[model samples]
Target chain A: MNSRVVISNIVRWVLLFFVQVFLLRNIGFYNLSAPFIYVLFVLALPFGIPNLLLYILAFGTGIVMDAFYDTLGVHATACAVLAFVRISFISVTVNRDGFDEPEPSLSGMGFKWFVLYSLLCIFFHHLVVFFLEAFRLNEIGYTLVRCLLSCIFTLFLVLLAQFIFYKRKSR
Target chain B: MRNLWIFLNRYNAFFFLIIFFVAGIILTVRNNAYQRSVTLNSTNGLVGAAYEHLNVVKRYLNLGMVNDSLAKENALLKTEILALRSIDSAKDVTVKDTLRNVQYTYLPAKVIKNSFTLRNNIITINKGRLDGIEPDMAVISPQQGVIGLVRDVSDHLATIRSLLHKDTRISVAIKKNNALGSLIWGDRNFDIRKAFVTDIPNHVKMSVGDTIVTSGAGEFPIGVPVGRVRKTNVSTGDNFLAAEITLFNDFSNLQYVYVIKNKYAAEQKALELNSKNDE
Candidate 1:
């Protein structure tokens, strides 16, 4: 609720949006590669934020991306789905007491736990995204390749962002 | 009402999530209609502007390659002009000669984005409705080979359904024998098959290197090369020989293309429609 927290959230969203649109848009490694750093916006939200608010914010983030990429509603669909699943993911991975905090940091959750958590979330987001983008089951193999490659790239970017932003003292 | 408000507030995220998912489903179902909606497309004015800027940056990066293509095409055009002038000097040319020398116009445009790896590939070109380009216009490379046809046209951009697309079918024929056939993609590799040509006399001596050209029966002009025969085999069920043709123009490396605007297209279409009605 503090002004500093609000400012930091705004700054993070802006930075992620720029990285996604301007830098990552054309950075396809092969024809099927996808850079999905936009998920960082969802992952960085405070743990105790209302589920409803998180979903709204996630949906909004997706709409902004969809607008830039001209991908119709694919991004929004995937982001919203990921946001809805985040509560279950956090509850399963972290303790209820730990989930009551104002911020979700990799440091707070410890290194190995945060890596697994971020990787799982990234995998879910990428899987849903590639499937929706493909809109078919005929080329399941190709879709899997896309999902894996995108998930790996997204996880790398997410972890890098977490390492740079969240200080050791936050743990 | 107080309880309802509290419950709604508690589930507000879920409510929005459901609404957004429903919207996505509706958009997917009505994709065709949504694609044609000017308002929804134009609403992303900032995004569109950003893409336009990115296009400019990309154009600079691709300048050298584009200039090379332009120079090569210019040389071809020069030779064509000289040939035309020589033919004109011989004023005793017959009506048949004039028809044979019919020249097609070419429009130069950049391929902003192309989707060849997908099943139903659509290419976005920089030229569009404002540039006298319209839907159904046949696009070809500078070498006078078939590329695809324009499917949709906005003010500044047009999407071409590439020949590599599974759903794309072009009226093509054997250039040597004038045998009519349809050029269709196998939907796997760049390989295409010319189907429904069962009646070509076996004596015509079909070979792997035989050239295939547009039949001029449809929107495409005559003499525009489609591809060269890659493989030939007779159908098991029918007497028709299916020939796999390798496309000369690579859809992946497409940079500049020409949009053929037939002056007599409207008249030809109307006459064909009338004949169909009579039948």
Candidate 2:
């Protein structure tokens, strides 16, 4: 990867961490729901990034968030699972679009596909995080409702950012 | 080897995911209170919670002079209260309140770490051998209510098997009739501080609000408040009564507790052991 791309990625990482811990941490519906738009950084990586590197990056992001939130390992575990899913997701869906080199973003992938991918990734991450934190068989229903609201909120924020940042692409 | 490497490469991501996923899981679950109560005797936390609590302990240690003075004052007040209670008991003709000798001495200790969520919850107290605390010593709340007993000891720390532990069975008796039973934390919910007193004969009448007290069993002293009875029923197998009691001290917010060391415990234990050996 070029120095420019690496610098941008690093910048995105720090920016997302700061935003997640500071701005978005408290912005939730009631006390239970919050958007984790920092997931955008993971979702925006190049489609061809190494699987091993992705896991490491996800773990690092999660650890930083865990430190800030004091949730310890919750975010890191969720991010690692998300990174694992993203690998297969990109390979099967985005790579088939005939682009020589692809970035996993709204402009790079078509609108419908990007929406579906973001929804799936955010839903999976939120569901894992909420259920893992609850960890009780009786609280499964409560955790499901919490996971669903947080997933939709996070996906909405991620898509909004994509629309604002990315320029119009040829159909 | 070349073919093996190629085949391995084909499934490398899945295998790697399994490894990293396990690592990630350990990171998350290990720090959580639910996992700590099951695995450790409040012995461990992730590196961060450990360090964060180390600072808290350091601050608590610095309050030594104040705590010492307060404890001394409390001991004096307790002796006065015990004398006053004896005088009051003489006035009541029907009530039979027992008086205890000063055989068990109390040592003040702060709970450095605690968990109430798991089946076998353990509490780490700041007192150990150096502080005259030993395994099997009864732990009581500030109000002289039963909490649990010391299980394991290190040089400067001890783990108390809280009343919430599944295996804990402190011998107790109903306040109304000195009928014997043992207190067991049979409930799955830790949030509700409750326990069951089992093995009392079906003939012993028990009500919902009856007080239960320690029967001066193997380790615990007599008359320490166990809990108040909540419900009663008989299991199908036996004709004995099972009385659920709501514990007095909230285990969730426990901070400081008194460890009671029995002066005559060694002699009592030896006599009991000799009897068993003879039998």
Candidate 3:
């Protein structure tokens, strides 16, 4: 809620957006998988931000991302869903009694919590995004394989970002 | 009223979820014809401009490799120019096909984005509607082979469906026997650069090294180099021959290409379609 935290979060949002659009868009693994690392923005938000505020931020980020990727509302929808469901995972996994971390980054949430959180978050994100992109019931087999591969790819990038950039240890 | 306000505030995120899903469904389900908010289609200048600036920097990194390919293409064109000049100089005495009416014109473009590994690969070129490029225009690499077809056009950018795409089935023919067939990309590994010329009768005396070229009657002009037969096998039905051809154009190394606008394509297509309708 402080000005400095808000400013830094804004900076992180912009940085993640540009990196996803610029660097990651071109980095394809056999054209089958492109990492959706921008979701790290949603994953890294202050854990206590108002649910409505977080959802709006995630949805806005998704829309802008969809604009760049030319997928329309696809990213927004997935991001919105991710934001809404994010709290459910946190309550169950995080050691809430002892830890009072504001952000849910790998540094803040302990390694295990962050890993599971990112895998689940990216899994659903890619699942919705790719399946929506294909939008065919008959091609469910192809769509599922694409979703699984992309989920793994996006999860790897999101996890990598935490280790590389989240230099300070919260614990 | 107090209870209603509290519930609304408590479930605000859930409220937006429904809104976002509805908006998403509308955007995804509508085809371009029904789409009014079509800027989300990478054809928008906002997205195009960003990619353009990025490609400018990336294109610089590949300068050496691109220069080599440009030189090779230039040498090939120079020899062709010399051949054309000779024919022009001898035109008064010799009747030639070069004297035939010009049917197509070439527009130069650079490939800003090309994905070689995608099963249905799409390519982005730095020319678009503003540059007189349109969907269905034939795209070919500088060295003379099919690249793809212009699929969509923004103001200054266009996307091409690469020949490497699984859906591509271009009309091609064997050079020696002139047996017509269609060319396709990999059946097993979609990333494979080779193409297969399918539907030529089994009796056609084809062998390894037999050249395949665009039949010239369809999307491509006649006789542009396609590929040479690298391997042949009986197509699954056992009646037709299918040859694996090593493509002349390297999709991975592609940089510049020529987009061909056939002046008579519209008229010819109308005539052909009209005849088909009669049948």
| Top lDDT hit | 2
Interface DockQ of each model: 0.21, 0.32, 0.24
**Reference-based lDDT, each prediction:** 0.75, 0.80, 0.79
Kindly list the per-residue Cα lDDT of model 2 for residues B17-100, writing each as its tens digit.
777778767887788776546446434556668899899998788787777677767756755564455354335556544354
For TM-score, the strongest prediction is: 2
Q: Kindly report which residue pairs in candidate 3 clash with one another.
A: B216-B221, B216-B222
- Candidate topping DockQ: 2
Q: Could you tell me how far off, in angstroms, the CA of residue B245 lies in candidate 2 after the best superposition?
A: 25
Question: Rank order by TM-score, top first?
Answer: 2, 3, 1
The TM-score that candidate 1 achieves is 0.44
Tens digits of per-residue lDDT, candidate 2, A57-153, equal 8878888887887777888888887887777677677544566555777776678989988888888888778867776557787888889988888
**What would the TM-scores of all predictions be?**
0.44, 0.46, 0.44
TM-score of chain B of each: 0.63, 0.67, 0.66
RMSD of 2: 17.6
Q: Model 1: per-residue lDDT, tens digit, B1-279?
A: 999999987666567668777876555445534443543666687688999999999999999887868755874684466346434444556556454443455577778897766667788888888988878888887655788899999999999998777777788889988887777775345433332233344456687888888898777877678778877774535655667767777776777777777656778889999999999
Which model, 2 or 3, shows the larger TM-score? 2
Error of 1 at A143 (Å): 1.0
